[model samples]
Target: MTTDTLRASRTFSDWIPASWAYPETGATRDLRFDYMRGFVIPLLFATHFDFFSLLMFVGWERIGIVSTAEIFVILSGVVVGMVYGKKVKRDGLPATMPGLIQRSVDLYRISVVMILLVAAIRYVPWIDSTVITTFFDAPNNQTYQLYPPLDGSLSTLISKALLLQIGPHQFQVIGMYVVMFILITPLVFFMLSKQRVWLLLGISWVVYAIHYGAPFQSLRPTGAQFEYAFPIMAWQLIYVHGIVVGYYKQEVVAFFRTVWGKWLIVASVLLSLGFMFLTWNHPLPHIPQWITLNMIPAETFHYLNNEYFSKSKIGIGRLLNVVVLFISIYALLTLCWQPLNRALGWFFIPLGQASLYVFFIHVFLLLAIMNTPLPGYKDFWINTALHIGLLAVVWVMVKKEFLFRWIPH
Candidate 1:
């Protein structure tokens, strides 16, 4: 080849690395966050729908004490912590606080709009009004129920406007999230600035303990017997701890490799298994009565109800189950085969990226399905198809950020 041709080829090669080269700048986006969020979104949808009792039969509720609700909350904390924590680290809290508050306000506004939309649906002639109104009556035993009083007094409207009365049923989680985000924005940043994260965490745990031990009425009124389903005082422990982890994710992961961290992981796994054994009903088929007797103590296994390990109260068993699951899942993701990881990431990451839109859309869809009395209740195949369609539709809608592209950073 001519000298000039050879020189040009060399220059172009230097400008662009070979296909095999791996860049040192790292990933532009962490697909793990999106994938995890995507994973939680379907589970959340299924829980809302009760998976037509399939989830119960599969032991998602019984043996697995932790619910997707907790995962969603913790993930929210992690995302907020990473995003706002970096901003605070870079620009200082003074500059970051306003944006944090603004984002919280945006979430609050979205929630209010959601509540109003659900309320208005009752007026549609074909749709069952009771479905919307009575769904949240006893949320522990129900889903998607919230209704405005017939009187609609000024006092009631005012309280609703102030969020002292959060909208019904599934909407309760939105309110808890609103409170958590607003409170954590300032609290997490301030704690970080003062290097008092541990102190903040300690206080959070104390509040959880007190709230769980002596449950109290919340300021918010939903007309349900309980003040709020989520009970923010206890759930905040998960939120705050998530923030610390997200803020110091690298450090935390490094610590997990240490002897103490490994031991802790082992303990967490064992505790989770013990809870499953105690709470589940014959999780392992055909086990000997003698073996069951030895594995599960009389005090632990004889209980009729597992509400002591319930999702509503954020029970101790539930908390430990999630901790172990979260850690184990994280470890598995890192250790999994590369091809499988890429495939899984490809499927879930987009849904996670557009999670906010997906969440809003799914709730509306589920509400319609539950209220309309759809025909697929008894058919396993139909239900499976419905779920697959739900995920597929959301995936397609969110793939290009169709409705969410305009959301401000």
Candidate 2:
């Protein structure tokens, strides 16, 4: 290592963002993950909006087997591990217990509030019944049962909400997180502290496997309706894996710099592209008939997507897709962090930093939009404008730190 060579290395390394060049040390927030979360926020809004004209290009589960929900969950787990894993390492598991408990309680509170909000909306005279009916009518959307029945069953609804068993379908992930924080996250932190990472993963895999035979459901108080969207037993695999990777982030990064790691990155890139090509025409909004590939027969595609890549079950195909997509995207961002950051970091980083605030507020925005005639119009330009306008409003709210003092972000 000559002095000139060392100088060049230092210069190149300095040019890269710290988040890309090194693992998070929990001393400072990692902007890269925040940016990814920020990026996912609008996609989430677009997907939920349903009739948005540009949904085919940006909707959930449209790109491949993956969705923004998966990204959010995995990134959340990674962050929990990075932050609390470090704490456990320094002060032991007991010291980090309060933070975990507080987080779980906060998530539970949010879930309850969201459930109440939806219930309140159902009773609002000005808000049209169409808002509730639209979701109720959709067969695929029935799983979460977004709207509670108005048949004078407030007691059941409130009881379920208090139990964290039911909520707005869109906010179901929050309820799932409430459970994960309470039951799973502490064990993850403990295992990481004990350096029993493989043992933790083995247990997670076993739970995920069991979910296949005995699928868990979040039944309502009456036990007739399964209101939970995410099956915790299955989805925990992704979250647990994220915690392990985040706990060993430095080691993982080092491995990726090795020859075997480079090979794995190349393989991931190829697989991701293949998945994208297969699903290029699978989005909600219709593409021109002439633009179709027809590589996989329509029947075959549907069967594979439903059986092997199902979102609720966190199916095998989705599992594979997320891993490859993460690897490919992580590598691309690492290589081009400086250029990409300069171009888009300003907008996304702030939103990502305040993602919880955005997530909470966006639900209200969507509800308000639904009550209007805007979604009924469904013009391409109108839909595009609506999506951009919604994102900008959220961005401004984030910039102003709207309710930051009161609301958890």
Predicted model with the maximum TM-score: 2
lDDT by candidate, in order shown: 0.63, 0.73
lDDT of 1 by residue, 1-409 (tens): 3454333223323443222221113232455666777777667656565544333343344435667778778877787777788888889999998898788888877767766676666567777645335554342555542555645665665457466353545545656777778866587779887888888888888888877777454433333212456777777888889888887776776676666776776676677666566555433332224323355554554353344565656778678778887775554444442444466767677777777777677767776776644434656556666676777877777776665744322
- Show pairs that collide, candidate 2: none
Off by over 4 Å in 1: 1-29, 53-59, 136-145, 150-155, 158-164, 216-227, 269-307, 371-373, 405-409
Q: Roughly what TM-score does model 2 have, to 2 decimal places?
A: 0.88
Which lDDT tens digits does candidate 2 get at residues 1-409? 2444333233334554444332223353567778788878877887777654565475656556788888888988877777887788788999889988988888777767877877777777888644433345353455334555788587887887787655555666766766777888988888778788889889999978887556345322223122245777888899999888877776876787666887898899999988888676453324454445666677788888878887877889989998998888777666566667888889888988888888788878888888788878868789888888888899998898888876688
* Counted clashes in each candidate structure: 2, 0
Clashing pairs in 1: 135-145, 136-145
Best by lDDT: 2
Native-referenced Cα lDDT, model 1: 0.63
Worst 10 residues of 1 by lDDT: 17-26
